[model samples]
Target chain A: MDEMSAESRYADWIAVHAGQSDLRAWALAADGSVRAELTLPSDSAMPEAPAFEAKLLDTIAPWLGQGSTSVLACGLTGLADLPEAITPVPAKPAERLPIRVSANDPRLDLLALPGLSQANPPDLLLGEETEVAGFLAGNPGFDGVLCLVGPRTVWVQISAEEIVSFQTAMTGEFFDLLAGHSTISAAVASTGMDAEAFVDAVSDTLSRPERLSQRLAALRGQHVLQQLDPSVARSRLFGALIGAELAAMRPYWLGQQVALAGPSDMVDLYARALDTQGVSAPRHASDGLALAGLARAWFAMQEHAK
Target chain B: MDEMSAESRYADWIAVHAGQSDLRAWALAADGSVRAELTLPSDSAMPEAPAFEAKLLDTIAPWLGQGSTSVLACGLTGLADLPEAITPVPAKPAERLPIRVSANDPRLDLLALPGLSQANPPDLLLGEETEVAGFLAGNPGFDGVLCLVGPRTVWVQISAEEIVSFQTAMTGEFFDLLAGHSTISAAVASTGMDAEAFVDAVSDTLSRPERLSQRLAALRGQHVLQQLDPSVARSRLFGALIGAELAAMRPYWLGQQVALAGPSDMVDLYARALDTQGVSAPRHASDGLALAGLARAWFAMQEHAK
Candidate 1:
C-alpha cells in the first residue's frame, strides 16, 4: 500500500493532555501505534476556558495534518468537560467512564476527556487517567498498584478492571517548592541526583520518620555547620520526603505487584525508595503509557459508537 | 537613692536580639529591670555584617541617650558574632560560651553575643540562648525542658544552670513556606488562624505524623472539592507541622516539666499541642523572658569581669 492509501486505511488520531505547567500531545495510528509526541507550556489560567482551547490548538498545530485526524484530549477541571460532550457514567474503580468534550474547531476533530474523581477517600486525577487506561490496555488483567511519580505523585490500587483505592502525595511539588524558593534552596542543587545520599537518607528517614521537619531544617544547618555537600543535601531532602511518603503508602505497596509510570528521575527515586521497603516496582516509560492511554480511549469510543 | 543615681550606681544596659524578620530591643535598668521594649523590621541582608549593626543601633537610638548604658546584642546567625569582644567559655549543658562582638559604634558601648553551637548532634541557636538565660535567672533552681518556640523553635533540657541538651525544629519556617508559596498557599489565608482546626489537626497528626505531606496536600484538595474553610486549612497545616515537631520532642516533654517562651500565637499553639499530649506547659511572656535572659547574661559578664 502506498503511504497516502496506507494512511487512509486507518483513522489517525491525536491524544492531548494538559498538566500543571505543560500540555502533552501524541499522534497515533488507528492500531494504537504512536507516530509523534510533543509538549508545550500550558496556560495555568484554566478558568478562562475558550482561550485555553485556542492555546491548545495553537500548541498542537505542528502535529495537525491534512487528514481528518481526530483529537482526543483530557482535562480534569470543568473547562475541558464542555456541556455538549459530557457523558456521566456510574463511578467504578478500575475504569470510570470519562466525560468528553467535542472540540468545536475547523482545523481538526477534537474530543476532550473529563478527569477522574472518586468520592470515597476523595481524590482526583486530571490527565493521568488516560495513561492508566493505556497501561491497563498493554498489561491485560493486571491486578496491582499503579504509581505515577511526578509533581503530583499518585498511587492507585487496581483489581479486576476497577480502581479500588488511591492516594496522592505532593512530594515532588514540595521538593520543587523547597529547592526553588525556600531557605533550603541554598543547600540544594538544581540537577544533581546523589544516589548514595538518596539511599542513605531514605533509610534514615524510614527508620525515624517523626524527625522529618527537624531533619529538613538540619539540611541547612548541616550545610553551614557540618560541611554537608549540596548535592547530598538535595538527595537527602528528596529521600527524606519520599521516605516519609513511602511510610504512609506502606499499606498500598506492601504486598502488591507494584509498577511506576512517570518521568525517569521521579520513577527512579520511587523505584529505589520502594526497594528499601522490600517492594520492587518496575518502571514503564511515561510517554508511551500516555499515548497508549489516549489511543485506548479513542478505540473504546469507536467500539461504543458501533 | 534617686532614680537617676540608682541608674548610675550599677550602670544601666540594653539587650537587643535579632530574629528571623524583626529586631527586638529591650532596655534594662542597672538592677536587671526591663525599662522599655520595642521592635523593628530586620534587614534581611544578614551577611553584610555592618548593616545589621547599623540597624541595631538605629533601631535602639531612641532609647540610647548618653546615660553610660551598655548594649549587648544576640545574633542567631554567626553573621553578628564579630571577633573583638568574644569571650570563649567551656561548653556546658545549660550554656555554651557565646562569642561577643564590641559594637565599636561611637553612639553607644555595645557588645554582640554569639549564638550557641553543639559539636555533636550538630545544632546552632542565634538569640534564643539569651532568652533562655534570662528565663533561668528569674526562675532560679528551676529544672526541666524549656522550649523557646518561634521561627526556629528550640527545646533545651536544663539542669543546674547548664543547657543539658537542645534540639531545634524549623516548623514555623516550613509553615511560612507552605502557607505563603507552596501549593498549600491556594487554600491558606494570609491571616486569621483557626484554633479549633489547629487543635483537631494537632490531635489527628500527633497520632499519624508519617502522613504529614499527604495531609498537607489534602488541605488543598479538600478546599477545591469540599470547600474546606481557609482558616481551618491554615490551622490544620499549622497543627500538622507542630504535631510532627511535638512527636519528635516527645522525649523532652513526656515526663518533664515544660514551659514555653516565644511569640504569643506560637507559644499558644505549642502549649495547646502539649496539652493534647497531656503535658501542661506554663506559658511565659516572650518579651519579658528575652529581656530577662539578656540582663542575666550582662550581669554574668559583670561578675566575670570583676
Candidate 2:
C-alpha cells in the first residue's frame, strides 16, 4: 500500500485536448486504463501561451505525484496559436514528433501534439488529426476517405497509414449560426428536426447545390406563407447546408470507401446524407478517439526514445 | 416661434424605417419636403406592440403637435414580429395601405406599412419593399430587376411596376459571421480587402459555385502554408461568397436591366462581380432609399384616406 502501489498509480500519464472553448484531460494508469478525467469548461483557448500550464494544472494537479507526468496535448494545445503545427499532407497522421513545451512545473512534462495541414487547396485541423490517428491505429489496413464531422467537417483521404490529402468545410459552424442567430431562426422551431424534411432538402440541394442560398431564403418565405411547419423548415435549412458540403466534397468521397467520425448525431446526419448517395461508410465514436490517438502518439514517443 | 409657425412645424408627418438593429425616421413637412431626421440606435425592434409609441416619442416628441400626426412606420415597425405583414408579390411595390395601430396617445397616430413577400420560392422583405418603392418612385419607367444588398440581400424582378417575383440570400450575414466569428477570421487580415484577389476569387467561384465551402477552407489552408497574403485571402473569401450568390442569381439578372442598392462598399462589390459577368448595374445609395420609400407609402396612404 506504500511506495510500490503509489509508483504504479503515479507512473500514469495524461492525455489532454483543448478545444475552442474548453479543456479536457484524461488520467491514465500505467497499464493504459483511464482512471479518471478532468474538465475546465472555459477559456482554455486563451490565445496566450502562458495560460496553458496553469489551466492544465487547475484540472489535473491533484493527480500529479513525485514523478513527472507526461502530458500529450492537441486541439488548441491550450493556446489560440501554435507556430509549429505541421503541414502533414502526404504523411502519416501521427508521425510528427510532439513539440516539447516549456513547462514551469517540474512535476509536469508537457508536449503539444502537432496538427495536420494541407499545403495546396488550403486547410488545417488540430484535434481531428489525433482522432484520425486513433482511427488508423484501430484499423491499420483502412485506406480511403474519413469524414470527421464537427464544428468544421474534415474529409481526409488516407492510404498506407498516412493522410494523402484532405479538405474542410464550415457546414457545422454555418448551421449553428443560421439556426441560432440568423432571421431563419424565427421561421423554424428551436428544438426538433424532421428526418424526412432533412433528407428531402439534402436531395434537392445535392441535385443543384448552387440553390443553397435560395433554399435558405425559401425557408423564411415558407414561414411567412405559413406553408411548412417550423421544425420541417429548420430541418430543411440544415439539410441544405450539408447538401452543399456533400456536393463540394463529391470528388473526395465519390467511388471510394468512406468512413465517418464525430459526435453521434453529426455522424448519423453525415451517414444519412451519404446513404442517400449510395455510399456506405463505417462510423467511429470521436469522443474517445482523441485520447486514443494521444495514447498512441505517447507510446510511439516512448519507442522513439528507446 | 409664433403659434402659426409652431403649427406648421408640428404638423409635419414622420416616416419611420425600423430595421433589425436600428430605427431611422425622416420628418416630412406638410408640403412633402424632408424637414429633419431621427435615429434610435438599438432595441427599437421591440417585439411588443406597446413599444411603438414610446420609441416613436423618444425620437420625434419635439416635432409632435396638439393635433394628431400621421406616423408611417415600416421595417420591424418597432416590433420583432408583425402578424399582418403581407406577402404581396406580383403587386406594385409599396402599394399596400398602412395598418392602423391602436394608439394610446391622441396626438400620436401610428400606421405600420406592409412589407412585400413572395410566396412561391418563399421570400419576405420589410424595409426593402420601401427601398424598392423609393427606387420605383424615382425611376418610374424602370422595369427589370433590383438587387437590394444588405445583411440579407433581396433580388426583385419588376415588370409593369409590379414585383413579378423575388428571391433573398444570406450573403451579407454569412460574410459577417464567417469573417468576424468563424475560424476564417484567424486566417485572414482583420481589414482591407485586396481588389485583385476579390475579382479573381469571384471569377473562380462563378465558374464552379459548388466549391464555395472549399474556397473558404482554402483561405485557412493558405494561412498555414504561408503562401497567400492575409488580406488577399480575406478578399478571396469575400469574393467566393459573393460569386456563389451571383451564380445562384444568374436566372434573376440575366439579360435584364439591373440596379444595385445597398451600402456603398457592398454596392461596389456587387457591381464589380456583375461587371466581371459583363453586366453593368447602376448603383443606388441605399441610405435614404428606405425613408424615401416610407414617405412614398405615406403619400399613397394619404391619397387613399382622402
Candidate 3:
C-alpha cells in the first residue's frame, strides 16, 4: 500500500472512534491545509496524558468524530500506549519527521522510536530513536507529520501526505534555570508578573538587546542598595529575559500560525506579551501531538503490510 | 499690682491691640488658668531692636506709632537708647521667662535667670530642672510658661498672670540615631517602607514590647550571614521600635487633647497610628511655639502696670 491509501485508512479509524465519543479531529493536508474539522465543548474534561500527548489530544480532539479525519503520526512506538482505538500509521525513512537531539540524557534512548536519527543521542535517545526510525522506514503511508521541538516547546505540523516539520522553543527550561538556580534568580523578588513593569522592561530590551548581559548587574545593584522598588524590578527582569528569547526566535515563526501548549496562566501572559510584538494569539490544543504522531506512523506500517 | 489686677490689665491691652491692623495677641494657659498674654501684629515681621527691646517694641508698636511708643521709654537704661515715643517697661525679675538649657552644655550657666529657685520642674517639661525652676522664680509677673516636652515635641504653656511651662519629645531624635547613625542603622537596607512587612513586625513587637531591644537581632543576623532577608528584617526592627515608643507614651497622654506640630507627613502618620489606640487626632500648630511662649511672657509684664 502506498502513503495515500495508508493515510485514508488511518483517517477512517479516527472518524469511527471520534463518532463513538465526543472527540474532535482535524485532517492535516499535504499543503498545510487543516480539514475534516469538528468542535467539542471548550470545557470538556480531556483524557490525562503526558504533556505532549495532552497537547495533541486538545488540538485534534476538536476536529475528531466528524468524518474520516486523517492525521499523520510520523513515529508509532512513541504512541503505542495511547488509547488503543487510535490506529498508528507509519511512513518511509525519507518521509519520517526529524527529531533534534540536543541533550544527551541516557534514559531518553530507552524511549526512542525507529527512523529517528540523533547526531548525539547522549545516552538516552539511542534505543528509542532506532525503534522510531525502523517504524517509519517499514511503512511509507503515514498521513501527517509530528515534530517534537526540544524538551518543552513542541510543535505538531500536520499534512495529509506526511507531517512536513515542526519546531520547539526551550522557553520553559530557560525560565526554570534563570529563576530557580542562577545568580540572576536572586535579582527577581516575586514570581507573579506585573504587567506594566514587565511590558516596559521588555520594550527596553527589545530596543537594546545588547544590554541583556548587563541587566543582572543593574538588578543586583538596585536591590542591594534598596534604590529600586523590588516588586517593580522583579517583573521587569523577567520580562526582559523572556523578550530576549522571543527576539532570537523571531525569524523561524515570522509568518507561521502556531498553537500554544503549556500551563494556562503562563501561556496567557506569554500570548499577551507576544501579541504586543505582532504575533497572533496562539490556538490552544489538548491532544498530545506525539501520540497522534505515533499512531499515524503505526497505521501507515499496517497499510504497507510491513 | 496683684495677680488678678495684672491679668485683667493685660487682657484689656490685648483687646485694644486685637483691633489694631498690625497687632496680634496670644496667651498660654496651664491647668485651665491664664498664665501669660502678648499682643503683636496679626502678621508682624521680626523686630529690629536689641533682643529685650525688640521684644518690648514688638508688643507696643502695634498700638502706638514710633513717636508715641518711644515717649514711654524714659528712665529705663535698657529703654534710653530706644526712640522716645516707645516706652521701655521694666520687665519684673519675677516675670522673666525661663530659657531652655541643654543637659550636657556648660554654656547654659552664663544666661541662667537670677532670683529663681533651682529646683525640680515637672517631668513632662523638657530641659534641665534648674533652668525651668530659675525662669519661673525670676519671672513671677510673667504669665507665659515655657514648657519643653522632649527634644523635639515642645509645648509652651502660658497665661496672663505668669508664664507657665513648655515641654518637648525626643522621639524624632531617637529614630534618627537608631535608623541613621548607630550599628542598627548599618543593618537596615536603605529602602522605602514595605507596609505589610513593617506592620507585621510592629504588631509582633506590640505583643512582646519587652523584647523590643532584642528585635534588632533579626537585622543583625541578616547582616552577619544568618541567611535571612535583611531588608525585610531591618524594616521590621524600625517599625517595632517606633511601636514601642508609642506604647510607652500612651499612658501619659490619656484623655487630654494634644496637638502635634512638626513635618506634616510624619505628624499625619503618627496621628493615624495613635488613633488606632483610641487617641484622638492631634491638631498641628506652626513651629516656634517656644519663642512665642517667651514673647508672651515679656508682654504680660508690660500689661501689669496699666
Give all TM-scores, in the order shown.
0.82, 0.93, 0.29
**Deviating ranges (above 4 Å) for candidate 2:** A1-11, A20-22, A42-46, A78-87, B1-11, B42-46, B78-87
Tell me the tens digit of each residue's lDDT in model 2 across A99-194.
Answer: 787788899888888777666665677777888888888888798999988777889888888888888898887887777777777777556788
Give residue B62's error in model 2 in angstroms: 3.2
Residue B141 lDDT, candidate 1, scale 0-100: 74
User: Cα lDDT of model 1 overall?
Assistant: 0.71
Instruction: Give candidate 1's error at residue A255 in angstroms.
Output: 1.4
Give the TM-score between model 3's chain B and the true chain B: 0.46
Q: Write the per-residue lDDT of candidate 3 for residues B94-149, one digit (tens) a residue.
A: 34432222222221111112111111122122112222323444444334323222
lDDT of 1 by residue, A124-230 (tens): 66666667777888887888999988777888887776666678888887888778766577778657889989998898888888888778877655665676788
**Model 1, range B18-96, lDDT digits (tens) per residue?**
7766778877777777666677775322344566667666667766666445777776434454332222222342343
What is the Å distance of residue A302 in model 1 from its true position? Answer: 4.4
* Candidates in order, interface RMSD in Å: 3.2, 2.5, 25.8
TM-score of chain A by itself in each prediction: 0.85, 0.91, 0.48
Q: TM-score of the candidate numbered 3? A: 0.29
